[model samples]
Target: MNAKELHDKTPDQLREELASLKKESFNLRFQQATGQLENAAKIRAARRNAARVKTVLNQKAAAAATDAE
Candidate 1:
């Protein structure tokens, strides 16, 4: 998912996406620990995706705060 796609989603939707990404990250880590992870690249991708979601969520929160002010 790209920033443009994430930007179109509401905060609630973003939160849900973040949660799922985190869950996936956890599973990836577990697989790695068990020496079953086939693709290490997925871990990096999941981390980056989570970061993107967090960045967007922060942007939305800041915008809301500014609007409130």
Candidate 2:
């Protein structure tokens, strides 16, 4: 997913998506180890998407913490 799309997601939704991506990454890694992975680019895409979600989550958390201060 793109950064703009990721940023538009609610915090909870981002978290859920991140969790799903991580699970998918794990499976992708297993596939690669077994020489069954057809799309190597998918692993990179998943990593970037997971990072974007994490960045959004961290940004939201920081904003909330600052607001609470």
Best by TM-score: 1
In order, the Cα lDDT scores of the candidates are 0.99, 0.93
Best-fitting candidate, scored by lDDT: 1
* 1-69 per-residue lDDT for model 1 (tens digits): 999999999999999999999999999999999999999999999999999999999999999999999
- Poorly placed runs, candidate 2 (over 4 Å): none
Pairs with steric clashes in candidate 1 = none
Candidate 2 overall Cα lDDT vs. reference? Answer: 0.93
TM-score, cand. 1: 0.98
Candidate 2 least-lDDT 10 residues: 1-10
